[model samples]
Target: MEQDWTAVGDALRARLDELGMTMTDLATKSGVSLTTVRELVHVLNTRRRQPRTLASLSAALGWPGEHLGSVLRGRPTSEPSGFGSLASVHSELQDLRQRVEALERAVRRTD
Candidate 1:
């Protein structure tokens, strides 16, 4: 099926609003470059992104890992029952990863 990049962009923008997150925040949290995040949020570039990038953004938004991928594929997104717990765990892991990266950077500066 041909994908709908525009719909993906709109959905991403709305999700960011719902989360009270700026594009930069999404980029940082998702580990995606700010320019790519901006492009997606603004619909400035409709080119498809890597699956990993879409999954990262979706995960950062507290969505199922394949939510954005499904959106891009023009399919209805269905969350499996009890997905909330898994999403929460994913969120916690992302937070821990960011913290570890920060700590590593701090240690590197002191070296």
Candidate 2:
């Protein structure tokens, strides 16, 4: 395929046109740089936009809350903050498996 820019960049570009705005217009309205706007379009076109790009695009478009996640970032949505947590302290998931089996056995005996 010719890398369907339609699904991404073209769509955004169309929206901008419909709103009577160029990339320059968006940059002017949002107080962002033209270079940043171009980079956002490029990345989104290539399916490489990051969270930071979405944030910038969102702010520029005045999108709030969960906007620009799937549209610009190619994901279902995003968290307001990172959700990663440290895995169990000194307790690998694999290590817990055997221990859990043993505990289950003990509980069964007591029942």
RMSD for each model, in Å, please?
Answer: 4.3, 18.9
| Candidate 2: RMSD to truth | 18.9
The clash count for each model shown is: 0, 0
Candidate 1, 1-111: lDDT as tens digits? 698888889999887776567898889888999999988877788775789999999989889889999998889998788675676666667768988999999999999
In model 1, the runs with Cα more than 4 Å from the true position are: 80-111
Model 2 agreement with the true structure over 1-111: per-residue lDDT tens digits: 233333456544654654445788667655667876775556433544455655555555544433555554344544344221211222234346867999999999999
Native-to-model Cα distance after best TM-score fit, residue 27 in candidate 2, in Å: 1.1
Clashing pairs in 2: none
TM-score of every model? Answer: 0.71, 0.43
Q: How many backbone clashes does candidate 2 have?
A: 0
Top-TM-score structure, candidate number: 1
